[model samples]
Target: MLLESLSPLSGMINLVLVLLSVLTSAFTAAVGVGGGVLMIMALAQVMPAAALIPVHGMVQLGSNVGRTAMTWRHVNRAMLAAFLPGVVLGALAAAWLLVRLPAGVLELSIAAFVLFTCWGPGLPKRALGRGGILIVGAVTTLLSSLVGASGPVVAAFIKQSQEGRLAKVATFSACMLLQHLSKAFVFGVAGFVFRDWLPLMLVMVAAGFVGTWLGLRLLHWLPEHRFDNLFKWALTLLALRLVWLGGQRLAGAG
Candidate 1:
């Protein structure tokens, strides 16, 4: 009797998670930050720690890749030319950073990146030189891997590029798609369980399709300058929460 009662509750909980996943994707699409960060909390609450981050990485990657593909032409190619090489450097750094440092440190650093992203009004009105953009890309991606929240950081750079809203989303999405791919490789080498995650992956990817489709339609409707500010603020809170979680873990380790 006890088991059966809990079983019904368990099913309800899972149904809620599935719905939440869809909304999370939609939220990020609308505001320009935080699909994975929200999903992290949801997954951790329901699953073992071992499966939480890495599994979430896979789902997030698929979503970002699809969004980028949808907005491919709008991406600022000049900025990408400056930024993508540094992403490769950042990816190479992920192997060392992921294992040697504590998760708490990574989380805190990532939160800090979001805070930086939040501080600005929405990218510098002043133009960054090509070299500056490249440096920003490498450092941001490196920090993102160490800190583990690449979206806001990437968004900030895209905003700084002043690529306009359409290009902002597209360029940010493309950069993130690459960044996540790097992180995925690192996790794969770390040997997290992927086979068991196939179903969840399918669900998140499908949600991404819906979210991106709706978000693109909505993007046309958003007023200029407003969404950028909103995106930064949203990223700030998400970053702080990750840092707090990391700090707690580090405290426990000590």
Candidate 2:
């Protein structure tokens, strides 16, 4: 009967993903990064390949919106101005090219990019002025479409501005919320029906809000140095798994 239903996933797997969404949200809230990527990695295991990005985008949109609401006062308005236009441009471009990517390529590319962001060489420390931030917005948003989550990339850009932790987290959440909103709009206009997934997505989002609250509390107790190390190591291991899985898929396709 589980298999006979019209649900996008079996009841068991759906329940598991809902739980994982909470846990992952907590992880990111505590560490200031990694939750979205981790959630996508888990979803990739059971979600149909074609539905992955859009569904992931919607969930992240909700997650980040919740975070943005919590940290609204800390957001950087100036940076937001520079970043939004690029988001629109990037979303439009992605909408036009929304052809289904080969699953192997999509997975492998995301894995490689995640690893690069986690362990890759640091970008030059120069301040990217308005024009520069705009460019960062465009480029990273474009990459986000392919990879589903590019928090690290956007965070790196925000870091360059040398904002303190609260501003950094708040601004990052605001930027991502806008970007994800743009992505969702593009997907909708592109004719991807999202109605069926709405029920599950709403549940995951409610769970994510709970996780975010708990994670923020945990963050108050966690030292930055230890959290950073743990976050990177965890993401690195996940990336390696993605690489292996992606490679296997590619080989099978060949």
Candidate 1, residue 172: Cα displacement in angstroms equals 1.0
Task: List the pairs of residues colliding in candidate 2.
Answer: none
**Candidate models: Cα lDDT each:** 0.69, 0.76
Clashes of each: 1, 0
Tally clashes: model 2.
0
Clashing pairs in 1: 110-147
Worst 10 residues of 1 by lDDT: 1-10
Using all chains and alpha carbons, the TM-scores for the candidates as numbered come to: 0.78, 0.81
In model 2, state the lDDT of residue 152: 67
User: Given candidate 1, what's the lDDT at residue 191?
Assistant: 72
Error of 1 at 157 (Å): 2.5
As a TM-score, model 2 comes out at 0.81
lDDT of 1 by residue, 1-254 (tens): 42223222255655565677677777767777777677777877887666666666667788788778888988778877877787778767766564457647766776675676567454444436677777667776666554455666566556556546677777877777777777676667667667766665666677777877787777778876787776767777777777788889899888
